[model samples]
Target chain A: MSDSIPDVKKVGALLLEIGGLLMSSGASSERIRITTNRIAEAFGYSCDLLITHRALMISVNSNNSNEFFSSLKRTSPHGVNFTVVSGISKMSWKIVEENWSIELIKEEMARLKSISAYPRWLTLVLVGLAGSAFCFLFGGAGLEMAVTFTATVAGLYVRQESHKLKFNPYLNVFFGSVTASMISGLLSKFDWGTNPETAFATSVLFLIPGVPLINSFTDLMDGNIMNGVIRGFNGLMIALAIALGMLVSLMIYQM
Target chain B: MEDAVLILEKGFWFAAAAIGFAALFNVPRRVLWVVGLLGALGGITKTLLITQHQSVIVASLAGSILIGILSVIAAHGKHAPPLIFSIPAVIPMVPGAYMYRMMLGFINLTATLNSENYAQLLYDTLHNALNAVFILMALALGVSAPMLVTRKESVKNLKLKRN
Candidate 1:
């Protein structure tokens, strides 16, 4: 597995970059550890990779080499991007199997990065449908579901726009939740459907802490207790933000 | 027959929701349908169990176990981690209503001036919140069970390969 010992600095940088990309894309710490290690081992080197909430570090040494290559990358706060994680997962294997040169791997990663999951309009449509699905599942009939579909489409648009503007994510959830809930509240107030109560609730389901909650538990199960606590705390804060928006809407409706 | 149809509808919508969220999360296009199917499976199982009068904890745990097993199989087939599927697949079962109800209950408990109803509201809030918490915990544990087991097996295989 040994060729001209790959340039340590270049390999270390790539490993850290992979770590940053995976973590920022919301891949869990454990997966980041295993994936980066595999990629390193495949490149005819051995490394220690540590992935945490704020940063990822990789250090590599060849048994016969005196100097070590190490790099640390800070992870950005990110929403889940499963496509990137899966792409890197698959690409790492391909690199091993094909014995891809570093330049080839770099070119592939850039190509993968350019592939958006869906166009903006499609994302909006699908998220709107998701909101409608939740409404229907919770007992909304056709009218309420339609209202939610529209409300959610608009709400998600606001969320996306705010995110692009670099608004804090929790604040985006708060504002987005309030706007969606208020409109749905108006629909329910007028007796628009068989289950008005459900319409009011499900529109905000889009903002629920589904991933963070599950990630926290999984992190804890994997003995990453600090990460578990961090994720759990972050999720609780988002939940509180959601609750705040809903409660505020409730107050407005009462008034 | 009507019951089966209603259950079928629930499953369909849950899968639809899964696809929606999966898209939002940017799941790899190649495997999106499998994730949707897994979500449907979990949703139908939970809905059926609830119809049978199973407690929320039991229903959620059972549902997530199905998701867990399916994700492990999918994890292997897809050559990716199980969480990539399980996370979005579990979204349809999130206790959003309970969370809202708990918050609403808190509002009432706080706004009231220590009246008899305040005690009731406090209890109600705590009860609903606890249900949300417990069901959530059940889901996480259930989904992780299969992943952890398979992960251990995979690790063993890797070590064997090294030798």
Candidate 2:
């Protein structure tokens, strides 16, 4: 609607780039589809949004895709809002169009979330079992309960807490895991409940950054170079956070 | 029966917790709850499936794909974004805990200078680390399967129209 003719192709390319970034950040296919739709609305176009893990591909009927991209490159701010980059290749576009949609994608995402250690109330039962096991391992009862209590509490809070304060989700998890781990270590020193491994495991289960890391590697394997690298870096940072948290705890306890 | 009721109550709360987290990740709250429920069901069924000698990876993958499709079912009616539900629902399956355990195992093994504990520590750590890697791979595959399938369906439809 702006007097300037919106370069539909470039806009499509931009959408793809944003899509790549979002996916790399661990957004699901559905999220990317909705985002692409929103972005298209922002740019004054009704595009058929085709999103995949590695790219956002749009089919625009308004103009030649290449020319539209050039005009978009010209009109965009010299720096900040969008980093000018090579447009998505036809092959890449085809791949994306082949793999993604705005259809029922929720079940998959939910299923993924269920694999965490603190997933169900059954997790509480598992925590109880773990506590008993820890008791058997360390020859002890009271300590594990405290650990379980603390871990469950931590798990509950981790869900409610804001990710905006997070430098990275992985870092948030690392700190959280460390907090749980330290509590376990201290409780163990007091000979409380089988050394609290169960509690620590239960609480820190929410902190694992496994999915993002795997996505990064898969994207790379799928030939999404930029997407893979960015996601892989994020995964690395998360893993590092966990490793660091554990290392620091170990050093402090002289374990 | 009482135990079953208790499990359902707790399951709903946990599912609610998962949905709440999914919402924070920017999924639409309503659709996410439904997907979360199905995912919980799939997750529960997964335990049975595995026990029944069904492949864990296939069951997990199918369960996730079902979650993905069911969430998208409302896309046309709501004009809603599918990711709003899908991404959050998938968060539980990400395998972050396994990686954490592996790291813990490695740390425990390395810090233990006692030779008697060394082999046991090393073996456990390696086994966990390997499991973490494989699960991570499965999670990725599970996430991507629906996307790939949809693309194929779309292409087929397009070709059908042309013919």
Candidate 3:
């Protein structure tokens, strides 16, 4: 529609970058496809996206001229960052609404990418607090709840440390669960909590694959069977890791 | 009165836990509390059904359905996609104790050498593991039912392209 020949290749590459980022950041395939298409069309190009569990491929055609350019990107599965998804979706909407030029769109994209997350300590504390709250919800009262809080806090710290040190993700989860259950298991022996068993059981609540499970389930129902099943299997493996770690601690304590 | 207090307390913790999970995953602060409240609603709904004698499976299904619907509405209201709210809302209902118990059962069953209780422990372990798996499946299906209707259609995806 625009008289200037839109650089279909550049636009396609940008769109592909965004898609891969969203995929790696844990967006469902549906969301990634829709958002990438929306952003591309706003700039006078038609986008076709093929999203898989490990990579994203995208091609765009300049309107009328029909000159097409494609990009292929290798993407690793990363942890969920919902705020990033939320922000990027909104940004796509704004791109079309304001009729922003390609330059403006690219700038906005980088800004979204660079946005800093909350402080590490804050995230650690909040997650610890959350795990402790779930422990209470599960009937751990008073001292049991307190131990759950402390155990989860320490466990999350270990998880973060492992992540920082670049440990394998599965190993990070296993070790985190091991640490959490170990704390709860060992402390419960000394009357530190009324429901030591409950603490040991509940601290691993933080490690549940709830997000992946939810996403994969939606993916399956939406007919993206491959991505859905892959993610579901991945979630199952995480659950198994959690179970194994908990069992290891239980076996040690024999409680 | 006692029942009401217990329900309220559970709701409170569920809300707190939801907020914590959201934070841990770095959900933005602007809509952070709203997601937590949605999780609380789900927790309260399921807790009420359980106390009223519903099966845990049925209660979880009902609760996740509630969460999925609320997440859809919240997404529109907050101008965000639904996953941001839905995923965290679903976390509070996870059956952690049963999962752990199932693992414990397996460890005990395998570690013991010629025990008469092996069959019973095997059964209990299988039952707990199945229960956990089934609850997770129920949660997924419940949420999926609502989310299917909310997919961004081709038209809506390009809604702002008119300019």
Candidate 4:
């Protein structure tokens, strides 16, 4: 496989696909660069990737000839799927060691993309539990945790439903936060918990943009400042949306 | 004895939170428990440091450093990217409450510009926002420090050795 050079166009498309998958799946910029470079090296080509928050570009040149190819892909909306990231990473290594063909890489990419996420109900329940845990960690009592749990589950459900309907990402966060805070606020109005404020504060914890916030910093540290700033700004906007939602709920409760 | 029990309890909640977030991120099932264990250890480390009178930001940095190192090792053994473990594990330390408060403060500041408490609101908002920002920076820096230092050798080498 190393002796025979693959088509530059095919290699370019493959590298772009790989880069696009990694980008949308929440891989850090450094990981995307390294993984694509590794695969290109395995195929006896030199590859360059320019990754951004919403798109990826790849340029490939052959070692044995003047063949050159460059292509760009607009990535799908960002989502966190560590399973895809890990699978692609492992596949890159396998491509190097096993000398997999371009068709094989495409097949593997399809398989990895098709891998099912955890069941919706399970994710809802567990994420709700996570919110309650945050309540406890923040010094909430049992009743507060219970309230936080209910609020979080409802919030996550609403968020998921809106996402399925293709709602704007910030609007989805606003909706989820409002739902969670409203639940906790109404419960607090009824005086059902020892510390209703804690429930109110922690119920929206599930909506925190952990991945983007962390990735932004990593990207900045790696000198991918453009992507870093975009991600960081995106995270901040989502956080503001969550806060606005909570403020709306608070005003409604006061009324 | 009481302190030990408190730390254990905290660790349990942290583990549950980490596992939940990890699942939400769709980390593979086989490594969910590994993420949980790492989350517990990292949370416990932070809690212990806080108990020792360290600031929250310092404790977070220390805990995240531990997570970074451990996740690198785990990534090798499990053949997964280190972020799979580190992101979820570090979630327990994210200052969600502070972030919320800061945002709330800003909202209130805007709505109460003529009020006497405006200065207090501005101060509190800045305080909370800065705290959140620094802790987040600490976490990112701490978690990436190991990988940054080992960049020359590369995580690829680590995986290669495992094979």
**Share of reference contacts found in each model:** 0.83, 0.05, 0.82, 0.77
Regions of model 4 farther than 4 Å from truth: B159-163
Cα lDDT of model 3 by residue, A1-255, tens digit: 344745787788789888887887778888888888888888888888888988888878877785888778998657777777888888888888877677877787777666646787888787888888878877788777788888898888898799889988888899899999888887655656667778888988888888778779878877899999989988888888887787788678776
Models sorted by lDDT, best on top: 4, 1, 3, 2
* Alpha-carbon deviation at A251 in model 4, angstroms: 1.4
Task: List residue ranges in candidate 2 displaced over 4 A.
Answer: A1-174, A214-225, B1-17, B53-59, B74-78, B94-97, B112-114, B152-163
lDDT for each residue of candidate 4 in A214-242, tens digit (9 for 90 to 100): 89999998899999999999988988888
Better of 1 and 2 by TM-score: 1
Model 1 alpha-carbon miss at residue A216, Å: 1.3
Q: Candidate order by DockQ, highest to lowest?
A: 4, 1, 3, 2
DockQ of 1: 0.72
Best prediction by TM-score: 4
Ranking by TM-score: 4, 1, 3, 2
Model 3 over residues B1-163: C-alpha lDDT tens digits? 9989988888888888888888877788888888889889999999999989998889999998999887777776678877788778778888887887887887788789578888888889999989888889888887766656545552233233232
The TM-score values for the models, in the order shown, are 0.94, 0.60, 0.93, 0.96
Q: Candidate 4, TM-score vs. the true structure? A: 0.96
On TM-score, the stronger of 2 and 3 is 3
Worst 10 residues of 1 chain A by lDDT: A1-10
For model 4, state the Cα shift of residue A10 in Å. 1.2
Residues A1-255 of candidate 1 have per-residue lDDT tens digits of 546757878888988888888877777778777878888888777889776788877888865668688777887887778888888988887877888888987887787677787888988888888899999888888988888888788788888888999999899988888888888888756766678988888888888777788888988988889988988998899889888887788889882
Tell me, by lDDT, which candidate is best: 4
Per-prediction tally of clashes: 0, 34, 0, 0
